[model samples]
Target: MPVTSIVKDPEALSLTVHAEFPVKVARLWDAYLDARQLEKFWGPAEYPATFTRHDAAAGGRSNYHMTSPEGEEFHGYWEWNEVVEHKFFEVTDGFAHPDGTPNTDLPVNRMVFSFDPTPEGTKLTITAAFDSAEDMEQVVAMGMIDGTRSAMSQIEQVLIDLRNYSQTFATEAELVSDTQVRVVRLVRGTRQQVWDAHHDAALVKRWQYGPDGWSMTKCDLASGIGESYLLWWAPEDGGQGFGFSGKILERVEGHYESSTEQLEGGEEILGSGVPGSVNQQTFTGTTGGTLVTTLITYRDKAARDAMLATGMADGMEASYARLESIL
Candidate 1:
């Protein structure tokens, strides 16, 4: 578990809580914006919190309540003051009534959440300022520190759940025929962005490798019909290298692209005379993002089964996971 530190500054009438997560900054930062994700770790272990309203933008307001073991409810609300994407945000937080009204008698604290990218991952620092030292001391004495620590302890698991959910969300592969396989995923970008990521050599090099300890050594992409392209990958340990080269068969700018991809120099691994596949990639705009569908047509059933045996679906999933980071 990552260490979570809580510090109090009486002179400044502030309390700061710090925690580090072994996840990308964007993922960690997104947790706050997502209402469902926030409910997973917004309170202590025993007292689960529920969000009634979550609007994550500057001037937005959020209302939530935590239920105690005895079924008592503690409501809270946040008035967002500033929001900077993937970096930090400021909000005024305080106790509220069950009907989403603030409790004027309770202490209102200003909280600033700072997300810093570290070598290991992301470090999140939460600085909360009260109107006076007495107010800060009053909250601290009410087990605020312990409650925060307990809540922060759940973040690691939340991140894991988010990752697992992301890897499986809207991702599927099915064999449509003996000679064809369709793979689909909801990519987090527009059609043009997804198209550029696939066609641009620089972006392709960042996510072409499907697994760890392998890197794309060379990638040459020509974006027109009848153009030629080559992509090569080498193991980090300088092991055997493999690649694919082919000519584009069809292209529709940001909508679709098709090419005949032939594996090069993998006879030992894939067996002799393994035929190539016609790979077609299609991108469509969706309400949430872009829907990317890949169709691979093999020469015959033998070629399709051979490709499946290579765990091609798993490789595609892994590669898409990498692509999600860049997008």
Candidate 2:
């Protein structure tokens, strides 16, 4: 791994460190914003860190603690002052008590992190400004520079692990029977959140589109059993698009929902003889997060085969991948 460049300016009472990452700016930005990703590289190896609270936005606060090899814990907090997506953020960083209360006895600093895209990858510059030169000296003596470098060295591996995990967790689809197709994904959210993504019209409009250049133009939902729901889609270039409306068959709030879907348009590709399908979705809480299982049962084998031949599974996978971003 490459070493970080650390510069100390006594006259300005500031310390700056420059680190380069062999990854895109979005990946680097996500590593800092996502709590699960942040925990992997926020501290040195011997002193692993865990975040109890993480909200990556202006006016938000993150409280975390590092557990040493000797079993001792050091708590800290960051008050985000400014945040610009994929660019930079400023935070008030300081020590805190175990209960997350500020520790006045410890040194506090204002830190700014700027991210710049490069031909190689992303370059991140972090500058910490102290109240006085004495404060800067005290923190340097306390191993701030060394600890930061060690922590930053772990990010490359973290990004690699994240990439691998995403590939492993991609949505999976299988033909359960001649008339039934099953699609499953392990989403990183609670059962309720996953359910809401399906039931809420606004959220559904955001991720239900299968691929790029397509948008959901309309979404109207009636949550009650026996109610009907309608959705519409259109291409960016004003090309003709297809959509479907469904009648709710079953509803078990936040757990299960079943509907009968009747497709509109694209009849030639979907086979005009193809019948509607009953789509049943189940949300189950799992150790990892929420397991979402969607089963589509056609009226007959011919209908199911026609739908599958139209690349429905590939479209579903793309849509589900988009849902992961919002969650």
Q: Could you list the CA RMSD of all candidates, in the order they appear?
A: 16.0, 14.7
User: Compared with the true structure, what per-residue lDDT tens digits does model 2 show for residues 235-267?
Assistant: 888887777888998666676677999888856
User: What are the clashing pairs of model 1?
Assistant: none
After superposition, which runs of candidate 1 have C-alpha atoms over 4 Å from their true positions? 166-327
Number of residue pairs clashing in candidate 1, backbone atoms closer than 3 angstroms, sequence gap of 3 or more or interchain: 0
lDDT of 1 at 22: 91
Give the best candidate by lDDT: 1
Residue 20 in candidate 1, Cα distance off native in Å: 0.8
Give the distance in Å from residue 136's predicted Cα in candidate 2 to where it truly belongs. 1.0
What is the TM-score of each predicted model, taking all chains together?
Answer: 0.53, 0.54
